[model samples]
Target: MDETQPLLPDPDLACDEAQDEAAGKDFVDFDPAGDAENPMDWPEAYKWGIVGLLALMAFTVTFTCISVVPVATRIVDDLDGGHASRSASVLLVTIWELGEAAGPLLIAPLSEMFGRYPVMNAANLLFIAAVVLAALSRSAAAFIGARALTGLAVASNVLNPAIVGDMFPSEQRGTAMSWIQLAPLIGGAVGPAISGAIAETLGWRNVLWMSATLAITCEAVFLTCFRETYKVAILRRRAARLRRETGDPALRTVFDVEGVSRSQKLWEAITRPFSVLAGSGVLQSLSVFGAVSFAYFYIMATTLPDILETLYGLSAAAAGSALISFSIGSLVSVAICNRALDGIYVRMRDANKGVGQPEYRLPLLVFGGFALPLVASLYGWTARAHLPVPLLIFTVGVMGATMLLSFLPLTAYVVDAFGLYAASAMTVVIVTRCLAGTFIPLASERLVDRFGYGVGLSLIGCFSLLFAPIPALVLRYGPKWRQRSRYTREAEAS
Candidate 1:
């Protein structure tokens, strides 16, 4: 290979693609993003292993956030609060998720710089320490700080889908990534129920101790098992090795495009997530709905313990047990939808003569979108009406079904719509909804106080109604918008 010959025209450079088209060079630049050595070509077993470990990590972090909800009363007492104690107590969950949301914007770039394994391992270790800090905290401020510290694992939350995108073909990605996507909802639903029992038998601090032990065990397994899979970082290492062996300073990876400084690329990467977030209509509608539903989930998860104990006269453990309904609902949705997701997309692509459009992912939203308002209305109004405890629990479960269903179609759509920029797009959705989740629960006790559960939830139910037709509207109008979109074309091709 001639070191001086300009590296095969970099197709990743849109400008170069245009120039080559006009010059009739018939040369396609090497694209490390999708080369034969692409991470997608890695063995399926290896990819599944990575997904499994990442799922375990995601489950751990999510559990840390929600398990504490069942113990909110104990935590408030432990912190020795005043009149405002209960509200302060529940802030723990919100603060922790806030950390989860913000961690990626600051830490994700390091993963891009170093590699996923090192950052993940390092973040896992830091996460354990944060759990320890939460366990030992003597004051509310200390506990809040520690909970935010756990947000260091935000990379796991934001990056897993990007990993899915990197490793799986577009057609098969929804099915494969469903395993990763499903973990959070399951983990979120499981923790409060089980932790309530653990809090009863052991203590609240022991809940943190239990979670720390889980995190440590998963970290040990992951450290021993997983390797880096980000293709650019992998190729950079390979290029460095060759440069060292051949004593040719010019040997470079495909990522080494002329005139694109490392800082410039990093700046672009840092800022592009927001740019894509702000620039796209498709992203805006999906993200707004995601944020609202997610906020609804947090409100429900954080408040259920209180709701059950106060209204149904259930014990702390029994109150936590109510989460079983939520967890079961989410699982049922994933089981049914994951099977249908890929088939729907593939059929649409086949119908279009092998040209794939992101809208193929929208039809499933027909079921999901309707489920949101329908269940929110029932859950909200029925709870407010002081219906039978069993009936209320059943309605909560129904809401869980709607919650998970609502999330899946939009997630698959965004992933297909954004492609290589999926991380940025996802980060936008995460940050927006997480902030909403963080603040909305703070108002939960107040909302129930002013409006009562029935009316308060009905308001939320009505909100859910607004976005229900999004899939249909997008299906009809999305192609026209995509024509005007700067990111949509790049996303589809990638």
Candidate 2:
């Protein structure tokens, strides 16, 4: 390794854990001070500034995925000789989710191999190129390909939390996570209206162009401002460089002092997340709940426009604006959860004789879960008969319920249980949800045809109800469940 020449290769800017019965050895240890430049050790203002920038990065990526699709319906129709099939339109909506689902699973692990900054910036730039291709797309196939490319490139959703976790301590992390979570929810709620308005005013191609411009601008900012945060990885790289350049056999890395390495560590870094997910019952339980809730949200996002536009005869813009109600619902739930979840955690911790687990975050789950199904049923029945907009807004309330109850549990549980692998655990959850999101647009029309909106939505509601008890059961038995995991016990002990 060279002192000045980078340790990890340029193409792969590059980047490790362990156990019991191995006395006098750390299970997992890495340098605390990395690269003289790890953002985790940056000044407070610097860290928070990166957080804000990343938040916008998140906003740009997410808003692009979600917002541009609705407006794309017009383009699809125009391309299809001015008569795109309803199902075809849904494919356009849902296929982007397929790309989203794939991106995190495929690309997130690369962060360990490469540094986080490089991976994130590269992905955003790729996403910008995809949007450019999308803007120039002449056929539906080209457009869908571009969408998938964009999705794959910007799979930053999984890594965003990891970035934040690196910046904040556990106790104060919820506030940061909460704010991060809000961006996607707001993006989902507002994307369609923005896109729809843009499409209706300018040609549909301009929507893609606008998204590309945003992506490029954001990418530029990230390249200019972002810093690497994975501490151990950076130190390992630094040590490797020092060894190569100086060629001192006695040369030791900061990581050597802390006992981390980058040589064979890359595979462990990539695979360990799955190992943690498989080994932890708590992760499994929380993942299921979170994934299902996420799936329902995607389903709603895919179907809501169809419901309003077709059934209510609302214009594209009006139907898109209806998502504002969903946005309101999400905001309301976020407000309620932020105010109350912490209080409940403290009270529960006190009641438990000064110790608490992630399960304490589940109280709102019961309220949110049960209420959503009932709300769905009400929305279905009323809307089936052409009820007032207020009735539809009430359905937004049900959707809001899901957000309120699920967000805290999902974010907190992974943070509590998997700790370092929270991003990976969230990856699993996002995969399932994004899959559901992709499927909904493909199937929404068929579902309504076969059973009508009343039945189809009611069915989704029932499924939600079935999964609602998940968090409740976890809250009840979470501690005992956690005791069975070697990792959880070790994290708690520390």
lDDT of each: 0.74, 0.66
lDDT of 2 by residue, 1-494 (tens): 11111112221122221122124232232435542365545688887777678778777876787775555567677877787776767777677778887887656567756768778877877888888888888887778888877777865677777776666654555566666656666776777788788777876777677777877888888888888776546655665676678775554432342333655455555565576678888777667666566655555665677677777777777777777777677777776766776667778778888775666667877676667666766766777888887778678766766665665556665665555455667677767667867775355457667887788778777776777887778778877887787546534311
TM-score of each: 0.90, 0.85
TM-score of 1: 0.90
Candidate 2 wrong stretches, greater than 4 Å:
1-41, 241-270, 350-356, 440-444
Model 1, 465: alpha-carbon shift in Å?
Answer: 2.2
Off by over 4 Å in 1: 1-37, 81-84, 258-264
Candidate 1 weakest ten by summed lDDT: 1-10
- Provide the lDDT at 109 for model 2: 68
lDDT value for model 2: 0.66
